[model samples]
Target: MALPGRSVMPTLGWRWLLIFSSIPSFLLLLFYSMVPESPRYLCMRGQTSEAMDILEKMARVNRVALLPGILVSDKRIELDENSDPSEAAHLINVGDGRSTVVSELESKTGAIMALIKLLSPEMIRPTILLWLAFFGNAFSYYGIVLLTSELSRGSSKCASYPILKHSVGSSLYKDVFISSFAEVPGLLLSATIVDRLGRKFSMSAMLLVSCGFLLPLIVGQKEVVTTVLLFGARVCISGSFVVIYVYAPEVSTRFLV
Candidate 1:
């Protein structure tokens, strides 16, 4: 659906793809409306009755039975004292002791000040590198999305490429739909490969492959070759982008995560 919109709009030289992209926006709004608040959230906010109701509904949906006394009032007791030093002593030493240190620091100075501390000499370089990687990946990903029609436009090696004479008019909406649909496969592929290959390897490989595909367009005059290369580049980059989104947060420190 998104593919046809993206493909057709640019081919016909339409400028309305912007408007057509709203279809997904509206669908997202509709879907979001159907979702109920999490039972955990309700419990946290002191709405035990409502949380119990949601839990019961969830059990029904899963074809399971709610055990008697399952939602007892005592079960809702908050663990405010669990953060005591004696309680956390063993767990504090489990990793690099960094989590414990950060927790103590934040407790003293609050999170914002602790974050500022992380920007000092010892942490600054790694922090900057991570930020740059995230920024570059995001910029490239969104750059492609916003310029898909333009990227798909123009001549390729074929006598007349599919998008050569495309207009940016009525087909704009359709083009956006088509392009968005095309990303689903890429997203699914990233999900499958990231865990298998390791996040860094998968992401770096995809970005390198994407760059390889795009390199041809810089030197090749044939419209067909350029078109094919651009399409491949888009897919590779988009897949890498998806992998990065998952990997970045996972690799961050507990505090950062």
Candidate 2:
């Protein structure tokens, strides 16, 4: 998919490719400012009115009215040791069955402890597991993609194998183009079910399902069969890869709390 962009502005060569690659990130930056700050973060900073304004904007944009009891649920928050209780500060209930309140804004003194806590016993297991999952998912996904042509060629020992008779090499680039899209359906499937399936279970299921697709490759199957399995594995890995990112932060947040 990215290969096609290099042909767009031939005069600039790789520069055009760089620009094309960066366009998505640049557009993300352009749209990011349009998003309101998290109301919880606003409450943490003692900016209750601003948070309420953002919630109102959100409700108006979504064409829904705010729930009766949850209009910022205004309250005071102290920002520092010397701060007054009556100083302008507020809390907002975001309908998560919890309200954001800032008794005191977190001081800079605990920054080191916060970083160190990520390696503590409660966090160590989940953090390490998520890391391994991400590493394996990326390694297999790119490994399959990069090895498609080589896999198509097969071992010379397999040259004598009847299943190796097909001439898949000459059209390898076309296969790459076709294989690139195999991840899209997986991405869409993930987006559709992730919330309903729950993060941890979905991640585990996708990983296992992808591994199932990889098993047939050990038999040195026919080129057509090999390609199909590889594409299937890539699709499953891509979906798991997307979920793992969402799942990791959830793990970290749950542990930290």
Candidate 3:
């Protein structure tokens, strides 16, 4: 969509694209006040009443009744590592000869404390894996994007003409635009298979498939074939990227960023 602008007004077009891209961020800022605060965070900070109110509001919005005694204040609960991390069950032991089962809540800790918790024995492995996964995704995604120009340079239709100075730039943009469209299908595929196959399997599968798409590029091929393979690889890598984002949050309930 920015192509027309770029063609018509080369200098200002790129700046306009950036300005338009930031519109979503501005929209988010405008609407942020309407977004609800995390009830879990509120509870973690010992604002039990606020959390309860939020929960009640949520229940009303969902047209469901709030269960009585769901948010008893001033309770210390120890999370068991062996327990299912997905489970939100928080055991509240108030030391009054009574116990209640509710959603988990931890006392608000400082950034250093949170970092320590993330690096603790139980969390270290997943933390490292998440870091590596994010690193790989970002590295590979941008590498592939930047690689488009280099890959197309040799195959540029304008290469033989030698007369069209702007042809190379236009061809590069076209290749980039085409490759970017692969993400649409990638997103659809991620959404379809993520729930059915689960995050770990989905991410691993996509990465493996992406590798398969990339391996053929080791040998020389025609321009069309090369672009097709790159498109396929991008689709898989993009899907894996989506899965990683979804998986990261599920890995730790406490580390809600």
Q: What would you estimate as the lDDT of candidate 3? A: 0.73
Report the candidate with higher lDDT, 2 versus 3: 3
Q: Which stretches of candidate 2 lie over 4 Å from their true place?
A: 1-112, 155-169
Question: Candidate 3 — number of clashing residue pairs?
Answer: 0
TM-score per candidate, in order? 0.55, 0.57, 0.57
User: On a 0 to 100 scale, what is the lDDT of residue 253 in model 2?
Assistant: 87
Q: Which stretches of candidate 3 lie over 4 Å from their true place?
A: 1-109, 155-167, 254-257
List the pairs of residues colliding in candidate 3.
none
lDDT of each: 0.63, 0.68, 0.73
lDDT of 1 by residue, 81-127 (tens): 55432333332232467876776876778767667856867668767
Residue-by-residue lDDT tens digits, candidate 3, 1-257 = 55664466544544655575566679899888888878766664567889898998999987898897868656434546674322244435454333221211233346568889899898898899899999998888887887777665554342343221344544555566668779879999999999899999999999899889877666566667777888998899999999998998888774645
- TM-score, candidate 3, is 0.57
Residues forming the 10-long window of minimal summed lDDT in candidate 2: 96-105
